[model samples]
Target chain A: MSQFFFFLTAIIAVAGAIGVVTLRNPFYSVLSLVCHLFALAGLFLLLQAEFVAFAQVVVYAGAVMVLYVFVVGYVGGDDETVHPWDGPAQKGIAFVFAGMLFLELCLAILGSGLKALDTRGAGFVPGFGSPGDIGELLLTKFLFAFEAASVLLLVAAVGAVVLARRRGGIHDEEQRLSFTEFMRPIGTGTTAEGVGTRDAGINLPAPAAPAAPRSDRETLPTGGERP
Target chain B: MNWFVVVSAMIFCIGGAGVITRRSPLVTLLCLELMLNAGNLALIAFSRMWGNEEGQIFAIIVMVVAACEVTVGLGVIVAMYRRRLPIDVDDMRELHG
Candidate 1:
């Protein structure tokens, strides 16, 4: 039963992944990625890593995939612009590399002599590493790393916000702000005022109106007309 | 532990190749995800075979990280599309300099 589940999840995951890479539409690709992530989460469940599997589904398949979908949908509305092409040489190289990696994995698996490792007393069972156990371990042994990860997440959030924020346009007093100015302390006031200021030196020239045709009476006369 | 994992790994390898060889950025991202998931499958298989919890833990971490990567990657793709008007990687030469 467990073996069946593992196979099922693996197949689904692989299929989804293939879909993601082969699909031309960015939206579909993101959807396929979600499917792959979900299947992987299920595979983790088969391995008796219930907590990990749940996290995989929730963090990756759920929240992360949705975020991707949202971004794709928001930005990629026109499909006429997307072009796909893989040169034969690039494809050949990729295949060769992938083949080599596959062979390496096979060799490692075969050479490990995994049969010698006894599984009888390994003390692991389905769901043994429950969320509670994971939480305990995370807070105890991996506390520092966990804290660091949180800080990293916070930094990422701030970075994303800064990247997405639109600065002053051409009319603003400062026109362009340096990275250091953007990151300066909020209360500094000097950099804050410059944030939205436009550059006066770079004023855009007014657009010229279309020329009007001259009246027929004002047209230059030909020799025949003068005669 | 059995024929299932071996077969799944093969599928994963195929998916990975497809992703790397594909010209579309979208496809490449998908293939990368597939490869990562395939690794998750192997980890799970080993965990079951060895009766150890570590494999499962690693699999979970991979999934989470994959999710984070995909989100950020997609955001980048969207931003790229807005600036370039097309998603063709071949024509995207802004960063070449």
Candidate 2:
């Protein structure tokens, strides 16, 4: 019974990892990551690290992934699958190096006396992995680091806000569109789109009105928006 | 538990390959999360072996750091995209000069 769950999560984790790297769509990649995290959390549960598993789901799969989905939308890939392979040569070298590392890890683990102890990995850690226990440790031993992490989050939040703020961007073209006496501002392309628009939030700079000369919008100096 | 450790190692390697070869920054970040989770898994397993919560504490700290990292990284990527810079990692050679 225990073995069944162990294999299930392990396989799912491995499959999700493969999906994350191999999937052509960024949205699907993020979704795969969610599955991967959940499976790993289940593995954590199997090891009886209940708090870590909860934290894994809440912090990683929940908050971090939501941020990822939002960013994927905000940073809008072209309305096409992003081919993640840089080149066969680069990918080949990367895989070769990773394979070497995996082999090294296997040798290290096997030689580190784990094999002598049989396949059983976890030792008895009575009441060690609970939230209360971890919380006490955080307050006592890791207090300083915990405080530092809070500060880090605050700084990071501020930095992200400053970085992502609009500055002389799509607003200019939209301003022209709104101010033009002749054309009505028909909401279509970039605005009022939902997440199901497929990893959406990639508002094309293409004007909604087809008849308008698109040369001006394309000529916007910095953002050479893909046509 | 040893099997879990081995799985974690496999995951870490897969993440490493993804980070190295992926063209999109978002996917690269996703791979980074994978690597971090692998390390966390190993740490938790070790915590069980050691019969202590120290490793779990350490994993929590790592998670916090990962969150901060992803936040800053995505911000930079979004900023770059907003600027209409080429999103490809190969094209981001301005740092070398």
Candidate 3:
């Protein structure tokens, strides 16, 4: 059963990855990426790394892929046209490099003689490496790095906001607002009847007469009106 | 079947080729991600064969880092797209010296 799962997960992962690369549409690329991530998480689970697997799903499949989708949506455009092949010279160079790397990797794998790592020992059991174990190790042995990662995430969040707020940016507001100011309630001025009445009063005078005629004129006036 | 390994390897090679040959930045990014995932498959296979936990750990780490990379990379791509409407790698010559 485990072997079946291993094969299943591997197939899913590889297929999804292929889809991600080969699909021309960015939306499909992101969708395949999510599929790949989830499959990888399943593979991790089969290997008894439950915590890591869940984190893979949460962080990669959940959060990061969403970020990719958001950026793709914001930069809405068709995929750029891709030339099928490179120039002969570039292709030759790439082929040579790829061949060399392939040879090197094959040689290394053959010569290393290291057997596949056996996990039939400590930390190999299902649910053995629980979230609590991870949390403990994160806070104890890897405390500094853990905190640093948090700081890094905070920095990334702020940086993303800043990057998303450049002049002529899609989300740039007319006024440059600080982070706190941006996050504050957008319309806190008034929510009561007074504000509603005030807004109506402000808009009333302009639409008091034949607003329909005005709009029609603005859109497409008759020949008489045009003259 | 060992054919699974062969299939995975072939997919990886194709993905690598796409990454190297594609001029579209988004396609390249997608191809790069595909290659990374191919690595994940091999790692998982090796872990299962050797019965070791290390390969799984490495695969998990790779996935995490890949996620981070894709996020930042897409963010950069979006920024570039805003500056230049198209997402072609050829037109992105702002850094060329």
What i-RMS does each candidate reach, in Å? 3.5, 1.9, 4.4
lDDT tens per residue, model 3, A37-67 = 7887786676556777787788777887777
Residues A149-214, candidate 2, lDDT per residue (tens digit)? Answer: 999999999998888778765677666666542332234343353333522433434444634645
Top model number, TM-score: 2
Instruction: Put down candidate 2 lDDT per residue, B1-97, tens digits, no spaces.
Output: 6687899999999999999878788898999999999999888888777667889889998999999999999988888887788777766878631
Taking the tens digit of each residue's C-alpha lDDT, what string does model 1 give over B9-86?
665777768766665565566667667767777776777676655665566556656655565566567556545545
Report the error of model 2 at residue A201, Å: 51
DockQ of 3: 0.28
Give the lDDT of residue A210 in candidate 2.
38
> How high a TM-score does candidate 1 get?
0.69
Clash count, one per candidate: 7, 0, 9
My TM-score estimates for the predictions, one after another, are: 0.69, 0.77, 0.65
Ranking by TM-score: 2, 1, 3
Q: Please report how far candidate 2 places residue A227 from its true position, in Å.
A: 50
DockQ-best of 1 and 3: 1
What DockQ do you compute for every candidate structure? 0.43, 0.58, 0.28
Which candidate's lDDT is highest?
2
lDDT of each: 0.61, 0.82, 0.61
